[model samples]
Target: MTERKPRKDAVRNREAVLAAADVLFTRCESPADVTMADIATAAGVGKGTLFRAFGDRTGLIRALYAARLEPVREAIEEGPPPLGPATPPLERVPALLDAVLCFKLDNRHLALALEGNGSDSPYRAEHYERWHTLLHDMLERIPGLTDSAFTAHALLAAVRADLVEHLAGHEGLPREEMRGHLASFAAALLGTRPRGG
Candidate 1:
């Protein structure tokens, strides 16, 4: 038996909706400002179609966030060193956290929406699990890193969207400065930093 493919119109509609949502989310001051109705109007699709395609606002946000993260995920999964599988645990651990921090920083609005939209705990999100597992696995490979599970959670917590937003938006921290701080923190945990000058 052959697998079923989405109809051409469904594919077109999905692309249109995603494109419209990307623009709306990027342009709006807050993700809350971009509603399903607004997205439907922007995409020239009926509200029912939007609901059918994405289930609801939370689902749509998850889909959009996943789409935005595809490149980063691909890099970690298949690209070159510091993030790829071939990199040493000491190097890759910090690089993975850096990638996550940069992703949250770059997609602040989307990340904020997906994490703060009141659907459920951000801990329960699929992406969170993926990051946690990847970090945990990397930390396990590092010598002297005994609590890989807890350490993974701790490191990821530092880059959580809410915390990143607090530092970036509320505290007015610079992006590079925040990245540096996170890198230093991760280095300390992994015992990968060189001795003082």
Candidate 2:
């Protein structure tokens, strides 16, 4: 049998709910502050519809996070240099980390919500595993880098959402400065000098 597409209203409701959740996540003081009911109200849908569509708050958050992260994922998977598959491991590794750092910086609230959700460990999240695997594989391609697994984890830890929040939100570090610091750190581990450093 052929797969059936969703009805028009279902499609519309999903988009509306995602948009409302996006706004709520961006504006809320904390991730937990934005609830399913609030998103339903904002999207002009009922709470049952929201739950039926997403399963629960965590499900909704994951969907929104995935939607927002699609571009970055596409870049890494298929786009040009620094992030694409064709890039050299050394170049791609740092580029990937930088992308993660930048993404977390850009989506502070959503990143925090996804990472901070107590129902699951951030390290075990599907996105985190994908990043770690990609980074680990890249690290293995470099001539002298050892402990590719640990190195990948360590590099990722530097850009963890909470750490990003602390540096960007609490310590007030400038974006360029943070990027520079991360580049320098990644270079030190990879046994190369950061460009111009």
Candidate 3:
């Protein structure tokens, strides 16, 4: 039998709970400070429902990952708004890199949560594939890549999130410089004649 889904209000409450948890966890320097009850209060949902819906801390982390995914995917796959149709795809590339770095900087908590979860979830795989595929697509449009995938893979590794974060955060590189370097590096790897190249 087809089971009935939760009511619209219940779905909305679940979304709110996830969003509240996301904000709290992502912004907190110490993730241990976040609690289910705290998320429930912040989301304006009952504590019992929170527990029932998310089960526990790990559950909440998974929910946060799932909740955050759409926006991340959209930002990368679909150019962020305000840039609109005016920005050429190549021109928007550096902006996209900056947006990605900003997302990681803002949501370091979710990255921490994903640290332990292996390749079991489809989400992590999707994230990897999206970046790799996007890099491949960009490389193919380069008017050079006789072997686009190989060149694209190399470009992807260069600007991979961990490396970018290490350079920008730990190494104390300025964000603008990091973005510029990544864009330039990717163009070089693909042998693309970038605007400034």
Give the per-residue lDDT digits (tens) of candidate 2, residues 77-191. 9999989999999889889988999999989999999999899788999989999999999999999788999999999999999999999999999999999999999999999
C-alpha displacement of 65 in model 1, angstroms?
1.0
Of the two candidates 2 and 3, the one with more favorable lDDT, higher being better, is 2
Q: lDDT of model 1 at residue 133?
A: 95
Error of 2 at 179 (Å): 0.5
Please list the C-alpha lDDT of all candidates, in the order they appear.
0.89, 0.93, 0.65
lDDT of 3 at 195: 49
Q: In model 1, what are the clashing residue pairs, if there are any?
A: none
Q: Against the true structure, whose lDDT is highest? A: 2
lDDT of 2 at 7: 96
TM for candidate 1 is 0.95
Least well predicted 10-residue stretch by lDDT in candidate 1: 188-197
Estimate candidate 1's RMSD in Å.
1.7
